[model samples]
Target: ELFQVGQEVEVVVLDFNENEERISLGYKQLTPDPWLSVPQKYQPGTKVTGKVVSLTDFGAFIELEKGVEGLIHISDLTWSKKMVHPKKVLSVGQEVTVQVLEVNVENHRISLGLKQATPHPLELFAQKYNVGSRLKGRVTNLTDFGAFVLVDKDIEGLIHISDISWEKIKHPSEKLKVGQEVEVVLLNIDLEKQKVSLGLKQLEGDIWEDFFHRQKVGDVLKVKIARLVDFGIFVEIMPGIEGVVFNSELDENKIENPAEVFKVGEERLAKIIKMNPANRKISLSFRQAQADLQKKEFQKYLETQSDRLTLGDLLREQFKNLSSKDNSKKEGHHD
Candidate 1:
């Protein structure tokens, strides 16, 4: 008779030397079922430490013992999860301790959870991800004016393009990158609404500080045209501070298409025509100052008149030519 004393015994080898192989087996097949009385061994909701064997999109396969493995669903992995993939959180061969939430012997499926076994992630997220927190994360999504940064699975913040950099940002891609590590400032966190506002520019010095508080009206700055519009050209005096150079102030008279004269990133020494500290705006004019200086220089040149007869003749002829040209141009336009 086969023994059932929870011990292994040696058995005789069958087959002869003429046979290709012989086998020696142990006697455990005649034993009674211990799992048939699982209450005597283990119960439901049992706390267990397991080793992660494999991973799936839904969750991970954890081996609790020699023959027992439990399924920890993605939903059961964390409390504040908004995951599309599970490999981001858990990996194979990692050790994880879980709680037995359910045990079914009919289909032989065991449900496990890591969330209930540990403290909620949201509570920890609130503590870890807070205002003024500098975070390095991935740019998962982008919009016309902003981008979304994934600091964690459940935690993301919107970095508006304006707040994306110290310089003027026309698009989010100019500053942010998809799957790139970016440092950001936590502007606000709305726990009730579950929204986070982050800024990249906040990490740098305020651009307006050097332009506004230090400078005043008529403070001439060597400016460059950052962009051109129908009304004016935006002249960048500094890296981030841009001032408008109106078309009316661009030349001695009228001009068509301000872009014709000024292109983007074109440098010119422009005079600060106006400055509004309250609005954080500055107006620049290059032609106006040039005209003023030219007029003063012309007056000084005229004062050195050595000959009276030549001066009278020069004045009369120049005055008559100016009058004739103005009338002729006007008549041509009428024609």
Candidate 2:
């Protein structure tokens, strides 16, 4: 402050100060005003790219410039339900582009729209795929009812546990892992509501169709009993073709409890006593069918025994004739 306006004053570099030499500062360094240029560079609803330099609990720090930042609320994170944690999506040092929603320079607040920056998943999926469309994707998230397949950046579809398999599914994780890529079918799509229902069993072949076509009532087919319960035994005739052998179908003599009659992973020949394609059900009769087969086999065995007995009797008559000839010879000699 004591130096004259024109007089030369030798000033020590502030960085060389012994106490805090590690510190660096920039204040008067000049740059073009973003407010003057931001009007032209980005218009309302215009999408632009930026870097995600940092993240916070409330929102994300997106670097619009070296010193300028825009606040992208977690609410604007996605068109679908906003994720709970921002860390799930972005990490430190990630580059992202978001839309400029509002520019409040007086408050020094830049409102950003991340949802607008990306296309809504429903819109993208509706345009890209159709209902009944088959696609393969990685399992990204799981819930009680279903799991979401990450088909694309803006698209995810839900596969309900029932839709996971034509066979009964005890749990979703039993059928798929979090990162497993699986084939899926788009069962229903709601573009307006941004909803999508998916099915996994559709990817595999339909065994029931073949069962109804190749087999009929009174048709005996070999089936493997998959599960046994108090009420019935579940038998799988084919990959997707399964039948319920009720306790009534199982002979009470053979099984006290249906569970005792059949165990999982056991194979047995069965008869299709009833079928309902509309309900996707098949009623099997193991007892009645087995009895019919046993009757036929027993009858055949009896006929075979009868033929053998007749042949044995004829041999006995021939032996008797020889014995009678010797006795007549003895009688002639005595005379």
Candidate 3:
């Protein structure tokens, strides 16, 4: 369209054959080749604005200038994996600032990066936070196993199901919802993988640890039977706290089988015979708890009748009664 029969234009002569009377001419050759100056103009790390011209599965073509186009690979579109497609982040005719990653004048190729124009959000997040740091973030997405929290711009951290809470839950929605702002502890940061781990339960603290700190062995606690097994019974001392009561720890002579004597949901007092805070385990004995309770009751009784019944008088009276009963039994046998 730029050339016409009557219009005069600058042209470059290629070759002439006098025998055939043929001449070759080129109009584009008159202008300078853009690739020759590409290296000097678009150095690596140089920022340039360009118009998105085309989109493909692999990358997007950006027109830096007339006759000069660069490729923004799909991987360089964004640092976050959440944005999986380049089309989601870029559109044709839209202007964007990109960083020049490489220039290959020999191959007429230029590598541009859309995300590299700015500092990586993950790196920034690490600089601002660390393991055990507490921060508030909004829940952006949820799955059966975990939830994604937006901790910073274009940066997300995962809250695994186990880290969601101390209590058992079927799903993340049971305790959290999308768009909910929650306080989470920064559990870990994997720079190589570009992953961040957040924990909601850490903010509330570990229930087992707290239980161990407050309770100890020999402590009597009322617990509800939760499950009966071949070896023993599992009891819940409190919500989210569970312990085991072995069959031998029960009144074995009177109760041959713990399951036959105890049913789930039945409440009974038990004494902690052993405790291991490292593994969060507790061993309970029901018979020992009963003995302790009876001893405490007898002590209270003695305190109430202290003036009337001394320890020695009470023992002698019991001995005299035992002697009379023995004599009566012997006389009857002789007769």
lDDT of each: 0.77, 0.80, 0.90
Steric clash pairs (candidate 3): none
Residue 68 in candidate 3 has what lDDT? 95
Candidate 2 regions with alpha-carbon error over 4 angstroms: 1-74, 77-119, 222-234, 238-240, 252-269, 313-335
- TM-score per candidate: 0.51, 0.57, 0.65
Worst 10 residues of 2 by lDDT: 23-32
Tell me the lDDT of candidate 1.
0.77
Model 2, residue 158: displacement in angstroms?
A: 1.3
Lowest lDDT sum, 10 consecutive residues, model 1, at 33-42
State the lDDT of candidate 2 residue by residue for 20-64, as single tens digits: 556444433445556656666666687877888888888887888
Model 3 / residue 224 / CA error / Å: 2.8
Off by over 4 Å in 1: 1-130, 138-144, 256-259, 292-335
Which rank order by TM-score, best down to worst?
Answer: 3, 2, 1
TM value for model 3: 0.65
Instruction: Pick the winner on TM-score between candidates 2 and 3.
Output: 3
Model 1 alpha-carbon miss at residue 257, Å: 4.4
